[model samples]
Target chain A: MSQFKYRADTEGMLNTYLDWYKQAEYILSLKPSLPDKFKTSKGAREYHRPQHIIICGLGGSGIAGDLVKDALGNEIKVPIEIVKEYTLPSYAGEETLVIAVSYSGNTEETLSCYVEAVEKNCMIASISSGGYLKKFSEKTGALHIDLMSGYQPRASLPQLLFAILKTLETLKIVSGQPYAEVIQVLRENKTNFSPENEQNKAKELAEKLYRKIPVIYGHSFYKGVAIRLKNEFNENTKIPAKAEVFPELDHNDIVGWEDNELSKNFTAIILRNEEEYMKERIEATIDIMKKYGAEVIELSSRAETVLAKIMDICHLGGLASIYLALLYGRDPALIEPISLLKKRLGEKVGLQKKLLEKLSKTVSQ
Target chain B: MSQFKYRADTEGMLNTYLDWYKQAEYILSLKPSLPDKFKTSKGAREYHRPQHIIICGLGGSGIAGDLVKDALGNEIKVPIEIVKEYTLPSYAGEETLVIAVSYSGNTEETLSCYVEAVEKNCMIASISSGGYLKKFSEKTGALHIDLMSGYQPRASLPQLLFAILKTLETLKIVSGQPYAEVIQVLRENKTNFSPENEQNKAKELAEKLYRKIPVIYGHSFYKGVAIRLKNEFNENTKIPAKAEVFPELDHNDIVGWEDNELSKNFTAIILRNEEEYMKERIEATIDIMKKYGAEVIELSSRAETVLAKIMDICHLGGLASIYLALLYGRDPALIEPISLLKKRLGEKVGLQKKLLEKLSKTVSQ
Candidate 1:
C-alpha cells in the first residue's frame, strides 16, 4: 500500500476498501434484531403481508435499495420499488413497507419520505447513523438501525446494504443471502486488487481508463453493480462515466459507438457474468464497441453466489476508480462539486433546515 | 424540411416527428376496448384489483413502460414496475397486470417475459405491430393492440405509448390523462422544432452539443424524458450521451465535473421542471457545472399538465438529436452497430429464432 503515494487518499479511502470485508463481517456479526415497534405495529400484528416494499433514499444510501432489488428481484415475493426522491409513491399505504435509509440520517429526500411514510400509515423501518431521520424514527417508534458515523455515505455501503438485507431477513421477506460467503470472497480477492500487487487487475484497468471516459455495461442481473461502478468512477476518479445494461443498450446505445473518432474517447468495461442469459448478446455488443475503436475491458467475478458476484465486481471497480484518480493526480476523497452544490443550496434555499423543521413538525403532529 | 439534407432521414424520421400528433390522435380515437379475455378473466372478474402492474419490453418498445411509469406513477393506485429483462418478477401472478410491449412483436426479451406472464397466470395484455408476441397473444386470447409497421421501434414511441396509456385507461387503472391536450401541445410546438425554423431551440441545442458528449439531467418527475433524450442522442446523433436524475446525481456525479479540461468536452442539458421540489438544488448544480467550465443548456416544457410537459420535452429532444446527426453528416436512421450486433447474435446464437419458436410451441401447448 505504501508503494503508491497516498496523498490523494485524504480520508484513507483505500484502507476502507481494503477493510470492506471486515465492515461486512462486523455488521453481520452485530445481528441487529428487529425493533419491537415493528413487531407490535398494527400492520404487523394484522399480518397482512405487505403488498410491496418501497426503499426510499438517495445517492449512496439509496443504492442499497437498488442492490437489494437487483440481487433479489426474482426471488423476493413482493415487488420492491426504490424511491430516490422527496415523496413516497401515492399508492404506498398501510400495506406498503417503507424502509428509509440515510447514512447521515439528514438526507433531505429521505427525511421527506420518512414524513410521508408516517402520514400514509405505511409500515416503516429506518436505517441511519444520527440525524433528523434517527430522531424521527426514535420519536415515532419506527424500527431504526443505527450505523457507525465518521465515514462518507458512499463508503458506508457495506453497513447500509447489510442492514437493509438484515431488516428484510428479520421480516422473513428473504432469507439465506450468503453474507458470510460474499465477505469471504471479498476477503480472498482483496489482495489481487491491492495496489502492491504488481499484476493488479484494478491497476491495469485504471491505466486503460486514464484520460478516457468509461462506459460500464452489465446485464439485468448486475444492473446495480454497473450503476455502483459508474458512481464509483464518478466520485472516485472524478471523471465522466456511464452505465447501461445489456439487451437495453443493445437496442439504442450500440449505435453511439459508430463514430470511431468520438468512440475512441471511451473505455468500455463489460461486467461479465457467466450466468447472464444474454451472454451472446453481450459478447456481440463488445465486438461492435471494439470494432468502433473504443477500448474494451472485461471484468468477471469468480464467486458463485449472486451477492458475492455483485460485491466482487464492485470491489474491483471501486479500486480501479481510485487508481484512476491517483493516475490523474486527483484527491479521490474530495468531492468539491457536491460540497459546492450543497453550500449553494443551503445559502439559497435553506433546504436542510426547512426539511428538518418540516419532518419534526409533521412527525410531532 | 427539404432545406436540410435528407440523406440521413431515409426513413422519414423527421416526418414522423411532424405527424406525432396525428399518430397519437388516431390511436386515441380507436378507443381500443379491453379484450374480452381481460373482461372475463378470473383476476378481472374477481375485482381483487391488481396488486401491481408490470410493463415488460426492451429498447424502443420497452421505453413505453418507462414513459407510463414516469407520467402516471404518482397517480396510479397500483405500483407500476417496468421489467426490462427476460423474466417476470417472481411475485407477478394472477393479481399482477402484465402489459408486454414490443413494437415489432419480435423483441426476444419481451417474448420471453410474455411466456412467463402466461405461465404465471398473470392477467396479460400486449401491444405490438406484428410478430411472435402478436401471434402468442392471438392464440392465447390475451388482449392485443396492433400498431402499424415500417417505422423503427424507437420512432414508433407515439403509437406504442398511446396504446399502453389507452390499455391502462380501458382497465380503469388510470384515467383522464390530457391526451388530446398533450397532442395539441405537440402540434403547436412541432413547427418551432422543424428544420426550417431558424429560431429553433432544438437546432440551437444541437449546435451547442455538436462535438460534445451530452450529459442530461432531470429531476424525479422527468427522469424518463431525460433517458429518452439520452437514447435519442445515442441512436440518432451517434454519440455517447449520459442521463442522471437530480438529487441522485448531486450525490456522486457532480464530483466528476471538477476537471475543467475534461469537463469542457461535455455539455450539460438540464431538463428543467419548475414544479420540482429541489429546484434550488438543480439551479445550484447548474451553477457548479458552469463554474467547472461545462456548457449548460436548460430545456423546460411550457405545457401545464404533466403528460403535456413530458411529450413537449421529448418532442424537442427527438428533433435536436436528428439535427445533431445531420450536423455530423451521419444517417440518423442508420443504426449500423445495432444491426451488426443483431447479425452477430443471430449467427452465433439465433436468439430471435429460438424465442419465436419457443413462444410458438409454448402458446400452442
Candidate 2:
C-alpha cells in the first residue's frame, strides 16, 4: 500500500478518521446503567416496551439516529423516527422512547425537543458532551451519558452512535451489540482508505468527483449512508451535492438526467447492495443514467454485518470528501458560513424563548 | 392580470392544473365504503385503531403519503410511514394500516409491498387506475379505489391524494375531511398561477430559476412541498434541483455555500411559514445564503388550514416547473429516461417473480 498525502487538512480530519475505531471502542467499553426508576424489585430492568423510538438532534449529532436506523433496519422490533426539528410528534407520549443526542448539547432544536419529550412523559435518554442538556438531565433525572469533548460534532459520530446503541442495549430494546464487529471492520479497512495509500478507493472517487456535482444514490438499507455522504461532500468538499434513494428516484428523479447538457454536470455514485432484485434494479438504473451522458460510479462494501457495512461506506466517503476539498484548494475544517449564520441568529435573541413559550401553550392545551 | 403564454407544453399540463380542484371534488363526491369485515353489528365501522399507518407507492402515487403527512403534521393520531421499496418494515403487522397507492396500478414496488402486506395481515387498502393492484385487491377482498385514467401519473396527483384521504376518512382513521377547504383554496388561487396571467408567481419563479440549479428549503411543515417542487423541476424542467428542510440544513448544508464561485450557480427557494420561530430561522438562513452569493426567493401561503397551505404551494410549484420546461424549449410531459428504464427493467424477465420468491421465503421463515 502506497501512502497518500493530504494538502488542505488543516484540522487533521484525516487523523480523526484514522482514530474512529478508538472512539467506538471507548464508547463501547463504558457500561450504560439504567436509572433506578426503570428497574424492578428483583434488580432487573422492567418496563413496558416502547411502541416506537424517536431520536432527536441536528447536524452531526442528529445523524447518529439515521445511521443507527440504517444499521439496524427491520432488526429492532419497534419503528424508529429521527426528528430534526424543534417539536416532538403529537403521538410521542409515555410509550415512546426518546433519545436526545447533541454533541455540544446546546443545539436549540434538540433542546426544544428534549423539553417536549419531557412534557409528554416519554421515557428519555440523552447523550451529550456538556451543555444545557446535561444540566437539564441532572435536574430532571433523565438518563444522561457524558461524551468526551474537543472534537467537532461531525467528527464525533462514532462516540454518539455507540453511546446510543449501548443505551438501547441496556434498555433491552435491541439485542446484541455489534460494536465489536463494526470497530474491527473499520480498523481493518482504515489502511486501505488512508491518505498514504496511493490506490485508495476514496482518492479515486474524489478524483472522479472533482469539479462535478455528486448525486449519491443508496437503497432502502443504505439510505442514511447516502445522505451522510451528501452531507460530507457539502461540508467537507464545500460544493453542492444531492442524495436520493433508489426505486424512489426511479419514480421521478430519473427524468432530471434527460437533458444532455445538464446531465453531464453530475456524477452519480451508487451504493450498491447484494440483494438480487436490488442489484438488477441498480443495473437497469445505471444503464439509463449512462445513456443520458451522466458519469456513474458503483460502490459496494465487503463488511460482514449491516452496521459494519454502513460504517465502511461512511468511512470511505468521509476520506473522499476531504480529498475532494484538497483538490479544490480548500481547508476541510473551515465552515465560515455556518459560523456566520450562528452569529446572525445569536444577534436575534429570544428565538428559543419564543419556541419554549409555544411549547408551553401546546402543553397547556 | 396580464395574459402569459406557454410555448412547449405539448400535453396540456396547465389545463390539468386548472382542473385539479375538480379532481378533489370528484373524489370527495364519492362516499367510500368500508369492507364488511371491518364493520361492527352496531351499524358503525369498528376495528382496532391502527397503531401506525404505512402508505406504499412510488413516483406520483407515493408522494401522497408525504403530502398527507406534511399537511396533517402532529394532527393525525397515529404516525405515518411512507414505503417506496419492494418490502415492508418487519414491524408492519396486523395493527398497522397499509394503504398501497400506485397511479399506474401495476407499479412493481407497490405490487410487491401489497403482497408483503397481505402476508403480514396488515389492514390493506389500495388506489390505482386499473392494473394488477386492482385485480389483486378484488381477489383478496381489499378495498380499492379506481382513479380516472389517461393523464400522466404526475399530473393526476390530486386524484390520488384525495382518494387516500377519503379512504382514511372511511376507515375512521382521519376525521372531518379538509377536501372542500383545500379545493376552495386552490380554486381561489388558480388564476394567479395560470400561464395566461402575466403576474403569475409560478411564471416569475420559473423565469428566475431558468438555467440555474434550484436548492429548495422548507421547514418541518412544508418539507413535502419542497420535495415535490424539486421532483417537478426534475421531471418537468429537466434540470437538477435539490430540497432540504430548514433547521436541519442550518447544521450541515449551509456550509456548502461558502465558495462564492460555486454558490453563484444556484438559487435558493425558501417555502416560508407563519410560525414565529420558523420565520426567524428562515430569515437568518436567508441572510447567510445571500452573504455567500446565492439568490434567494421566499414564498409564503395565505391559505387558512395546513392542508390548504400545502396544496397551494404544490399548485404554484407545478405551474412553475411547466413554465421552466417551456423556457428551455422542452416538453414538460416528456420523460424518456424513465421510459427507457422501464423498458430495460421489463427486459429483465422474472424480476418481480424473483422478488415474490424471496418474499415467500421470508414469510415461510
Candidate 3:
C-alpha cells in the first residue's frame, strides 16, 4: 500500500485555519439587524444593460468559481467569464463587472486582473483577507468583503461561496437571503472531529473508505460539498475521488456499477440534507448502489449556515483525506505533473498565436 | 505515443471526411422532395414525472445522451441524470424516467438497468439500432427509436443527438423550436472545407492539430460537439484533451491562463454559430488568449439542424483527430485501462450496492 503523508500534527493545520475562519465569522457577526428588503433582479435596470463579469483566481479558488458558474450558468443572463491568466477580456469595458476573489489577496492572477479591471473602468468587488485585492478595493471605490483568513482556501469555501452569492445578489442576479438558513446551520457547527460513530462521521467515513476509492454522493446544496470532498481526496489524500449529484446519477452512470468489480476499490459516502424532495431519492440511490455491492456512509450536516455546513463538511473531508494522503506518503502540496505541463505550455508559442489570429478572421467574417 | 496505431486508413482519413462534405453536394444532387421529417416527440407525460432524470449507456452511445443533456440541462426544469453504470437509482420508481440509450443496444450495464427500469415501473425509452434494448422495447411496449445503423457511433452522433432532443421536446422541458434558423443555416453549409483555398482551412486545421491537445470551446448547441471532439481526441487520438464552454470558463479557469507557460500546448478551438450574442466578448477573450500565446480555432456550422451542424463539425474533428492519432501511432479503439478497471469493478461487491441496502432500511423507516 502506498503511504499517504499528511501533516505531522493536525493541530498545526487546524490552528492556522481557526484564526482565519474567525475573521469570516467576525465579518458576518457585525451585520446590523436591518429589515430585510429583498431585490428582484429581473426588475432591475441593470437587467436590461449589457454587462460582463470577469472572475480572477486559480486552482481551488478558481475551480469553485468555475463550478458555480457552470452549475448556475443557464440561469445567469449576463456573460460570466473566469480569468485564469493575467490579461482581462478585451470587452471588459466600463460595463464589465470584475470580481477579484483570492483567499490570500496575493494571488498573482487575481492581482494582475485587478490592475486590468481598474484600468478598464469596470465595476469592481473584492473578496479576500488583507491582500492586494483588499488594498486595490480601498484604492478604488469598490465593494470589498474581508473574510476570515486562516483556513486553507478549500476549508474557507463557504466564506468564499456566500461572499460571491452576496455579490451576485448586489448585481441583482439572484436572491441571497434564502441562503441565510444554510448560513445559520453552518454557524452552529461545533468541531466534534472524533470519527466516533455519529460524533465523528467524517473520521468513521474515512476509515470506511480506507481500502476504497471514494465516490461522494449528495443532492442540492451538498453537490458542491461532494465536489469539495473529491478535491479533498485529490489534494489532501492524493487518492482518486469522484462526486455525482442525485436523481441525475440514476441515468447512465448507474449502469457502470452493475458489476461487483467496480466496488473492489470503491466506497460511497452519501450526504443527506433535510431537503424533503431529495431525501427520498437519496435513500433510493443508496439502496440501488448497495444492491450492486458497495459500502455507503450516510452523513448529515451540523453547521450554522449553508456556507458553514459546506465548510464543516469540507473540513471533515479535508482532515480525513489529509490523513489518507499521509498514509500514502504523498506530498499534499506538490502537484508536479500539472505544473510541468503548465511549464511546457509556456514554452510552445509559434502554432498557437497563428491559430488565434486565424480564429479572429473567421469570427469577423 | 507508445507505438499506437490508427483504426482507419491514413490517407482516407483527411480527404474521405472532406469527401463526405462533397456528399453534401449529393444533397444538391438530390431530387428535392418532401423535406425528410424525422420523428418529433410529443409525449412529456411519461418523462418529467420525476424531479430528476437518470440516463444510462456507454461510450459513444452514453456520451451522445450526455451531450444532449449537457446542452439542454440549464434550460431544463428538472435535473437530468446520466449514469454509465449497471444499476438503477434506489430512488427511481414509477415517477422516475429512465432512458436507456445504446447505439448497438448490447451494452451489459444498459441491459441490466433496462431490466431494473422495468421492475421499478419507471418510464422508459430505448434509442438503439438493434440488440437487447430494441428487443426489450418491443417486448415491454416501451417507446423505441431504431436509429440508422452501420456508421460508427461517433460518426452517427447526429442520429443520437436528434433522437434525444426529440425526446426532450416531447417531454416539454426546453419547450421551443427557435433553433430552426440556426439549424437551417448550418445544414446548408457554404463555408470552404474544400482542398483549395490558400488556406484549406479544414486540411490545414487537420495538419496543425497533428501534435497538440485540442481544447474545444463553444457556447450553446456546439457545447456537445466540443465534448464529442474531446472524446474523439481521447478515444481516437489517444491524447489528453479538454473542453470548455463559455460563461463558466470566464469565472475561474480564465484566470489560470495567467502565468501558464503551458498555454501553448493547448489550441483553443472555439465552436460558434450565428447565434452567439457575445461575439465581441469572445473575440476579446481570444485576443487575451493569443497575447498569452495560446492556439485558437473558430469554427461555424454548415447551416442545418443543430444535429446536422454538430455531426458535420464532429465528423470533421473526428477525421482530423484520427489522422493525428495515426501520425502519432496510437491505437484508437483500445480502452485497455478502462476495460481492466471494469473487470476489477465487476469482481467486487460495489459499495453503492451496500448503500442501497442501507437506504432501503431508511426508506422503510
Instruction: Give the worst 10-residue stretch by lDDT in candidate 3 chain B.
Output: B32-41
iRMS values in order, in angstroms? 1.5, 1.4, 12.4
Docking class of 3: incorrect
Fraction of the reference Cα-Cα interface contacts (below 8 Å) that each candidate reproduces: 0.83, 0.73, 0.00
lDDT of 1 by residue, A75-194 (tens): 878878899888888888888999999999878888878877776778888898898888777666767888888888888888888889988887777886888778887787678877
Specify the poorest-scoring 10-residue window by lDDT in model 1 chain B: B38-47
List per-prediction Cα lDDT, in the order shown: 0.80, 0.80, 0.56
Question: What CA root-mean-square deviation does each model show from the true structure?
Answer: 2.9, 4.4, 12.6
DockQ of each: 0.74, 0.68, 0.05
Q: Which ranges in model 2 have alpha carbons more than 4 Å from their true place?
A: A1-7, A38-47, A350-365, B1-7, B38-46, B350-365
At residue A97, give the lDDT of candidate 1. 91
Q: Candidate 3 on B96-180: residue-level lDDT in tens?
A: 6677888877665676677777666677777788866776665555667677565555545556666666555555545654345
Judged by DockQ cut-offs, is candidate 1 incorrect, acceptable, medium or high?
A: medium
Q: Which ranking of candidates, highest DockQ first?
A: 1, 2, 3
TM-score of chain A of each: 0.93, 0.91, 0.66
Q: After superposition, how far is residue B31 of candidate 3 from its true place, in Å?
A: 22
